[model samples]
Target: MRENEPHRTGPVLIVIGGLPATGKSTVGRAVARRLGGSCLGIGTTRQSLYAFAEHGGDTDTLRHAVTHGLGYSVAYALVEDLLSQGQCVFAECVNSRKATRDAWAALARRTEARFHEVELLCPDPTEHDYWRTAGRALAEP
Candidate 1:
């Protein structure tokens, strides 16, 4: 039989939050890769909103609201689903506000999974601005 297979258990939930150009997605993906887990990007959720707006669903403002509202719900659902199935998940998002962070924490509580918050910071102002602008340019496609 396999070695130590019976002791394996559920996966951990890692929630990453940061500002624009803060490398939340980059580092979250790295952590998830190392841990053999999955990474979910909030931007992917927003892109779906943009697509809906492009298809004449709503205005930009409405799209933003709907994306923000639905994105968290979707993210939470992903984490819950992964946990239920004995898998781990890593979520990357700006999570600029305390309320958003708190909501994730609450989800962790309900799922009985450990939650970790990691913030990315750039010590050099110039470097931070450079990365921010460069990231924006690359994101523009």
Candidate 2:
């Protein structure tokens, strides 16, 4: 994100997405590191929402229903700001739906930043299940 680098003028948004426990976060972090940029993860954003008490409540289920939308809103705003400053960004999300994927691409188009889509897949059911269950438990308190 240095000012003197030529790539600064050409902002890029690399989106890493896939099914649960497919290594999307790992790949997104690696891609962001390689590009010398920052990473925005939806899971982390959602967790933050939970921590901040912005998630589901008895009064209204609308916020709960739009949890993903809330994450995307924050992510898109961050992307717009970062791209406007000519900086690269990496976004990590499950992105299980075509609409979600297309929305990200549209965000890139609007920001005038180069869009790179990376989808990770794990063919081995055992490994995928391990990460889906045990891996998460080990990583969390």
lDDT by residue for model 2 (1-141), tens: 577533555789888888878988888787677667888888887677656565446524545744748767777888779887878888888888888889888988988999988888999999899889976897689
Q: Please give the TM-score that candidate 1 achieves against the real structure.
A: 0.84
Candidate 1 error regions (>4 Å): 1-8, 60-62
- Those runs of model 2 whose alpha carbons end farther than 4 Å from true positions after fitting are 1-9, 54-68
Candidate 1 backbone collisions, by pair: none
Q: What is the C-alpha lDDT profile of model 1 across 1-141, one tens digit per residue?
A: 356333335666777877777888889888777667889888887677667777764577767776567777777787788876666678888888888889888877777777788778787888889999998898786
Quick one: best TM-score, which candidate? 1
Q: Candidates' TM-scores?
A: 0.84, 0.83
